[model samples]
Target: MIDLLKEWIINIASLVLFITAVEMLLPDNSLKKYSKFVLGLILMTVLINPIIKIFNRNFNISVYSQNISRSIYDEDTAKSIEKYKEESLKNTINNFENNLTQIIGEKLKEEFNLSNNKLEVKAEYVTQESKFEIKYIKVGINSGKVQKVEKVKVNIGEKNIEEKDKLHDDIKSYLSKELKVQEKIITIYKL
Candidate 1:
């Protein structure tokens, strides 16, 4: 609390000193003699500086009381966090697939400029008897509602079957005309 007060006082004092030094350099006349120095000092120190100090005090109290650093995570906490992240990502992909049917229904409205939501994207991974299959759907606005779908098959033993890379080429090809996404933007990898 004391430190905060000191900082605010320093800031206001610096500003007043700078303004007073500038005012002193002006031409010396009868009206500019004693009155200018006194008025400038009084206005800066009494009015502007106090108001600034009040604002700074309120801001400092609010920020300190908020206790933002209490949310920091440790190493074991970080590992559990990563586990949750992977699970959530898997659920997200499944939800995307389940929502695809309804999403496709709205594709026509989007493509014809009848709706503000212009694109619908869906992705899924299918574990087959001997291999893995990735499927992606891109529904967008073209002449009317246009839907494009792409599928990629990968063997279980393939090291390149990371999630992001698995569908990189297919997604790029599918949405090439609709979205100007760069190659680096799409990433896929297995957990």
Candidate 2:
């Protein structure tokens, strides 16, 4: 142990002297500015590396690098998984909304005897205690034209839109009562 201590002291002293000699030989230039910082970092690594290895028998460069790479990989994997989950959730919500709109369109067509209709439904919802509740739902509907006698349109132009809009009071009344939503959120147009 005594010999080891002496050897360590001698090694450190020689390293310090060598660094000083190198610094004296190098010109004070832009290159030296960058090189000195690099040199100092290398010196610190050299100074501590042997000490670390001596105290920690299990320490190795390959193991340290592998651990660093593994941690980075884990972080990247976690990030990708989160991204995928977010994308899937967004797609699911979009699909649900689209399907809801389709169902609403079908029900309206069946009741009103319309052949084709476009229905857009918007809703404001909130989650409380992991339970979802809708605050308000807005509905916008338009009639489409199909070139057949069986396919009939409610109102096709601006002139008919104004006339047809007033005729949807029964529909609005039904939706307001059935869905338990506000009357202001429901809009039906025949255009």
Candidate 3:
């Protein structure tokens, strides 16, 4: 074993010396550093080659890798962790949106002079880079059996916003401040 190790060490030293000589002979350029790095990697592989050979027949690499992987991530535990993450994310976003809609409902009550109990608050989520993102807020005003207003005609409303629109500007500024997002990403609606 000592003779084998000594021979391996000699071989590695010779290879490194040869690589160094070759690199010194080459012209300095943008690729010189990269070439040196590759040569270093080659020397490392040569140094480790014999050590790997020493263990070649003694251990089963496939089984060892399987056991290590299992220890790192058990199937059931991985599944459960993924599920927990999804649920927690969903719950947190839902609670935030619920609170947001409630606030909007109060604001709507103030804006439209509606009673507290009649506004149905809901939110619509639009897809961003991820699966779901808050895009539009819908506040349903259900003034049940109000004298003349219930009979008034209602029309479908468009949500296009211009820079001159004060309500959109106000709401956009408010949301941008409160939610810490750009106004361009949010839209509000009343139904």
Candidate 4:
């Protein structure tokens, strides 16, 4: 077992030295990144190969090495990887938007007693900020039925309840502050 560990360490050190030498020889250009990425993957495979062998005595590193080399230079494989990355990013963004809407809806319902709520959150990657930024938020409320005054109002000294217009402002203000968005970018409407 100690011999095996020593052999793995020697192999990894030699690979690292080889990779560094090759990286030094590589010209600084767009293709350098691809070369480095492939080299890094190869190094990872080398690092994991010993562990794999420990578990499966019949495991073949040569086959995996050949496959990795074959796929590394394949243009179709590169394009497919790029496409997969794009699709993954889109799915993540969609999930974030859905989750944000649900959370905001629940918060409004709990805080403002606003039900039948709809929310639209538009977000985009901001390169300057190095993060995703919310472009705008649109909230729609569907519970806008005015109940009939069941009795005549005879009390002249009682404070009136907060109005719906104030409620709209409050919701907008709350969302703007909570989301770190401008009030102008947040639109609240009755449906």
Which number leads on lDDT? 4
Cα lDDT tens digits, model 3, 123-167, are: 344436444455555333344454453354545594453334565
lDDT per model vs. reference: 0.52, 0.66, 0.65, 0.84
| lDDT, candidate 4, 1-191, per-residue tens | 99989999999999999999999999999989999999999899989989999899989988877999997869998899999988977887788788888889998988888888878998766658767777778888777587565555566777533225887899989988887889887778765
Shift of residue 13 alpha carbon in model 3, Å: 33
Candidate ranking under lDDT, highest first, comes to: 4, 2, 3, 1
lDDT, residue 91, candidate 1? 90
Off by over 4 Å in 1: 1-8, 11-71, 103-191
Evaluated against the true structure, the overall lDDT of model 1 is 0.52
Q: Which stretches of candidate 3 lie over 4 Å from their true place?
A: 1-69, 106-132, 142-145, 149-191
Residue-level lDDT of model 1, residues 1-191, one tens digit each, is 68857776777677678667857776777766676767676555544544565677554433543665445556778999999977976897777655653544353345433343334444545546432223444333233345465475858876544344423355445444443444443333221
> What would the TM-scores of all predictions be?
0.25, 0.43, 0.38, 0.54
Q: Any residue pairs clashing in model 2, and if so which?
A: none
Per-residue C-alpha lDDT of model 2 across residues 138-158, encoded as one tens digit per residue? 444444554345455576555
lDDT of 3: 0.65
Error of 4 at 117 (Å): 1.3
Query: Any idea what lDDT model 4 has?
Result: 0.84
